[model samples]
Target: MAGKSSAGRTRAARRARWWQLTQRWRMVGVFEINTGHEFYSLTSMMKEGMQACIQATSNTESQNSLTDEHFKTKGTQLLEGFEMHTFAAPVFATLRHSLDISEQEFMNSLCPRANYLQFISNSKSKADFFLTYDKRFFLKTQSKREVRFLLSNLRRYMDHLEKYPHSLLVRFLGVYKIVIPNQLKKYFIVMQSVFYPDERINNRYDIKGCEVGRWTDPETGGKQVVKVLKDNNFKEQSIVLGPEKSWFERQVKADTAFLQDLNVLDYSLLLAQQPLHQDELKGKHSFADLVIRTTKSLDIEDYPTHLEPSSVPLLRSRSEEVPDGAVCVPGQHQAAAEGDGEEILAQEINSPAKDTRCPVELQGFHKHHQRLLPNLKNAVHVIDGLEWRYFVGIVDIFTVYSIKKKLENLWKNLRYPGRVFSTVRPTKYSQRFCRWIHEHTQ
Candidate 1:
């Protein structure tokens, strides 16, 4: 009787597998009547956009990587007469090349194989965040106003990327539009995810540095879930960048300078913390296999096997084409080890010119580690919460100086009396933000 029951369970599992094999995969989205046109049309457009990106960044035409010989926008004109724009190869070639993202990988991230898409929603905004199956690029719904702002400043942005191909400025891959017959045109912007799908970040914060309107909304669950937090939350726990503190501070100065000059404001500094030496700090045996533990920390078990960069045809094609002497591989380890990066770090940090570019994210492809060690420099280890590293970048930079901001200022002023908030004019906000960061870093 027990043998018969076991055989019956085996049969049920086999049947489930067979059914799954026959059904293929389902595409998810917000649609009205279940017309399959959305999947077909959008996927095809994304493919075209990918091809264009490949052509733009092809090394056959220009031996120099990301060096624009003669630049042109990469896009596709759909059957419906509307067009979609995406990062074609030549547009930000050096930038993409530096990030080790190939055109095929980029396209796959944005369009993906029809079934490899997952729908995600944001409660704070009308826009929805759609993550590709691989979790490389974040496809976010955008408003016409925001789209226009992006389009208008795109050239300047391209120039910025070109100058500092590896810079940590919010990497915007493409902007796409879909005409919905009777409805308004749907627009989407593809951006790089701050947190890697493989890595685990125990502590994260969306810091605006401003006291006013920076706190996470009270209604949203705090710490229990991912919430955009602000100055007060950050102040509760101090940050120390250790020996590289000076380097980190300088990088922020350079980044903020570019942002301020552009009149871009209201962006948040996204911070992620990764604890190191947990066993040692907790006074446990260090014999618990460090290699295995580290391996598990950056594991990508959740993603499908096909998502690896090497497996993608586009990445494979362009993989060998990375230019010699390129700064794609990080060279910070030796310098950080020797305790002799002040001059070099100074150049990186002090350069506020548009032509200069640097990536200030948690870099190191092999290590991909943040330069920020614990706050051990100023306080005692037991009392100072000093067993972690940090990753930070200024993100959500689409908002530009506009009439909307002016109106917002008027509204905020009326809403909150005897207080100035982050809603200040672009010039004023930039000054405050940069000043605050400088002071805090010091």
Candidate 2:
């Protein structure tokens, strides 16, 4: 019994040490980011690609419209045994700038002082996700076809964002490609995290306004805390919106229309729920102020960035099999580690002047809410009666209604007649999605 107890204590100590070294960092199996072993070895290709892309963005001049040259501006770099390719470097750079993410801030967020990139497990999509230490942005692995579609519709998407600056659509910050020694290729698209405000989200749902297969299994029960509930799992609640309601309703309509025009489908409104504190409900603290305070509250000195293990460890081999699960599912095991290094909020200083060219509805909406940060005001909806603060954004906008989707939709409809599957035609899908959102939010 004494020996068994000793073994248990030893295991506990090792676990504590791991958490200290990683500051509660979570990874897939044994995958981890160690500077000594990984900085110049496993992840070197990605680091080199990012550095090259940042430099290309720094050198390129901003353009209102993309030209053939912009798409052709391929910056290639040859690292140890890997080849890194950046697609439309200047064009993505302009997108980053337009979002007010400066080059320095961008570089810092991706390649932080800790040199750690946490792997997100079991993404429902075909792609894998890797989050930065600060969690400001995450890299989603994409298919070559998806990349092509995005580039083709790049101009229209940019125009939409420019016109409807407050659009709740997910922001794609950058795109990249890496070729391994065997000539196998990997594509990555970096996107701003919708829930990056560092708020404590109690619940999350991917609402598509569809009913079939949208409900969570009753067996999960309390375990749902780690899972993202779907449309059917969502409870119907009356949500009260401030003046921002007009802006949100209008933007959703416009954004969905934009997606329909691009033939994009299978997107959903990603919603997160945060239970409000008594002080927050009483207006002692505005949600905006809480977000800002939470962001700046983290003192960098508290978490020293230079800690390293006594010796370099072997790198974990990359698994070719794509994990099957939801995006960024904070599994029960990772609960403790998920909160350690939450966010290092990127403050946007010297923001561009508001465009007076906005339509009267947008102008009126901006007048009242402009005082709050754009992201804060746009993303948050506090319902005092419900005692919940809701964070929402439109996500998974890449799936296009191509020939493959058409066939899939047809097959599904035949299999389950009168059932709403997510793979419908773009126009009808967007209309249903918008209408569902309108009805649910009301």
Candidate 3:
């Protein structure tokens, strides 16, 4: 009798402990779902949307196949209160237009009774938040003014929800308002919305220029004049002549290895060969003409009068074509002669009787060459696609302190061949190519 009583007591104690453990787990699960970042309300809306989808397909085998346990899941419970009339028709119509799919097909693929129910259920059970990856749905609504109006209405409805924040709804509607039919436009909108909405708005709505006045260089102590060119002009120039002076400077600074191997003289010659005359027509013609003519003219003071020279000839010569004993390349000397005559002519044409101070000032040929060549080549290498990709990838991966150890290990396995030249590698005669890359990248 005593042994039986003891066994019975032990069994009772075990059962009680198991019951308490189960209740504790239930409470912990409830806390995870309902406290902190709970999406209870969003889950409710998702469920409602899902149930409507299910009811619409009630006659289909897909709907009928769902087990009783599926209905008992949190997703189904949320959908129990859903009304198909609220979202189904609008959502279907929008998707039909955006995806170029029939309403029936979209419903079959996207809001399938099983997927709808499963997603909602999973959101309620496991996910901290619910997000739809269906871009077609957003795009469809964005393409139509009527859909936008409906979204505005939806925003108002959400605003009326007791727990919904006004700021959140405002941001959501702001995004909905900016969608367009073009995929590129839509992509731009989405990117801006996710990463830079405030910056976009500030650019769009704030037309006022800098209140603090123009930027002054700290080292130079001179007011910096920022020339804001139109996008079309900037892109055109970039494609035709390459990136602007500032872009080149930044690239040169970023790649130290490229700078070290660069042949300053060859690099300067290439820059001088660029059609500086064509760029002169765009308001800032004189600056480019000055830089080009000054580099070639060995006589620095001659650049100011080179822009309007008589009989400006288009000279084409290779590196070997340079005349013997020419301090600068023969092509550069010819360009300078033509540019000087052109500048004089331009000055006479633009102002007949008044003498204006030309901005062109010449430094010594060798001195200017030394100063500019390294920077120019470094800039060119930095912009080279292969070089830029390699360096940028390195910078991005190695910056994180926690990942540095892992990256160091991986770096051992990644072979960087010294012979692998960048996309802009100089022809076989070029000795400065590697040096240029090394200087800029380092």
Candidate 4:
């Protein structure tokens, strides 16, 4: 009986060892299967002539660059032994059953940094075999430095690949350095869409190409046709400027008369060329307006002096109640009480003033009302420098209102670097301009 029991124990131990070995081999097989799929996808793509685009830069130049002769001869010998096999079916089945990734998603996963590196590294052996067998793959892969950068910045490359799978690999690589500007451009586009309150300009005006004209009050059955005079007598318009014959001076004089006749609110003329309706012009009631007419040939120095800063208030009151979702100053509380003010006040204070400047007395307004200043900062950063320059004159007025409201709400929590009045004045204009730019650029 004792002998039989000992034999039974030995048999059970042998079965346990066999199970362990099987499990070990199973895991190894899984790794190889995954690695093999990556290899097959890369080779297939390469053979099909789907070239990866790469951007070049001077900084990437190597001092000790190798000539083609150094690698080509040896690379050719290595290409003879490699073989290309299709694994689309097995790869698809494995992804479905094991990785649980759809075939499309699995393909997309190949785009980002980490996956790209893994794809390249896992296939190195196969690539080496191809190099030994055919040599072409080696020559193509070795021809560029960007391929190395893609391999090196694998993690970032992978994250971006997933986020922008459709983007070219070369552009994907450039994103590491240019991401801030690119993201800023995208954010500006989104903010413009939000702020501009898209007016159907097509419905309001007859703007064929660049010439603008519209029948005023068409919907109300009135015919007040506003038309700009055509520039007739082309030769007389083109006369060179001199003491007695300054054609530019004459045009400025004519333009001033034309603008005055229109009675466009002073600053409204700055944006007159913009496809805005009359009602939109009326919306600028919260701020003072300026009008200037300059000929194409007139230098900026020749422009007339703008209104004195002292004439404008440090803080201008809104003509209407603060819109819902707009951040406001304490002075606006009276206006807020008149509308759905509760909703604006109910918003949790998470952001700060869009304008960094706010008076001490007004600083507490944003804290009390719940504003998000960080978000406002982020929004301001979205405008491109070039776009800002193009609309610099008009943006001054719009940013002032936007900044003042933003500061008024976040007055308690905000701080600035200069005198309250000085900081407030310029900041007001900047905020208004940025806000307007944020709107129109979209």
Arrange candidates, best lDDT first.
2, 1, 3, 4
lDDT of each: 0.50, 0.60, 0.25, 0.24
lDDT of 4 by residue, 1-442 (tens): 9999999999999999999976553232012213356444444433222112111111233223233332221111111223211111221122122212333332233233221211111111221222211110111222123333333333443343233221111111111110112221110000011111112111111111111121133232232222222212111221111111111111222222222222211121111122334643353222332111111111234222362423222232323333343343433221111122211221222112233223232222232321111111112111112111111111101112245545653552354322222222232322222222222221
What total of clashing residue pairs does each candidate reach? 9, 0, 39, 42
Candidate 1 on 1-442: residue-level lDDT in tens? 9999999999999999977764432211222112364554554554455445455445444225333432444555444444445424354544454455666566555544443344422236666655556545666778887877776666677666544433446777566666545644677776776654314456566766678756665333322234445676667465554333434444455555566667777887776666766654554212233233323323335323655655322223321422332232244422111121212333333323222122222222222322212222111011112355555667877677779888988998899876758776655665555545544542
lDDT per residue for candidate 2 within 1-442, as digits (tens), equals 9999999999999999977866532332123467664333535567666876686557556676777788667777776677778777777778776666788888887765555454432236756666666767878788888888888787787777766554678888788888887766888888887766434766667888788778875344423124567888775653344323334544566677788778788888877777777866566244455445333322224323453322111111112211232111111211111111321111111111122122222222243222122224223222222356667788888888889999998899899898887888777776677656555553
> Considering only N, C-alpha and C atoms within 3 Å, which residue pairs clash in candidate 1?
53-88, 53-89, 56-89, 56-90, 57-89, 57-90, 66-94, 164-357, 364-368
Q: List the residue pairs that clash in candidate 2.
A: none
Better of 1 and 4 by TM-score: 1
TM-score of each: 0.59, 0.68, 0.18, 0.15
Model 3 spans > 4 angstroms off:
1-36, 54-84, 87-91, 94-130, 133-148, 151-442
**Model 1 worst lDDT window (10 residues):** 376-385
Off by over 4 Å in 2: 1-44, 59-68, 113-123, 218-225, 276-363, 366-387
- Ordering by TM-score: 2, 1, 3, 4
Runs of candidate 1 exceeding 4 Å displacement: 1-71, 77-89, 111-123, 158-166, 180-184, 217-225, 277-386, 439-442
Question: Which candidate tops lDDT?
Answer: 2
- The alpha-carbon RMSD values of the candidates against the true structure, listed in the order shown, are 13.0, 16.7, 28.7, 28.9
Off by more than 4 A, model 4: 1-101, 104-143, 159-440
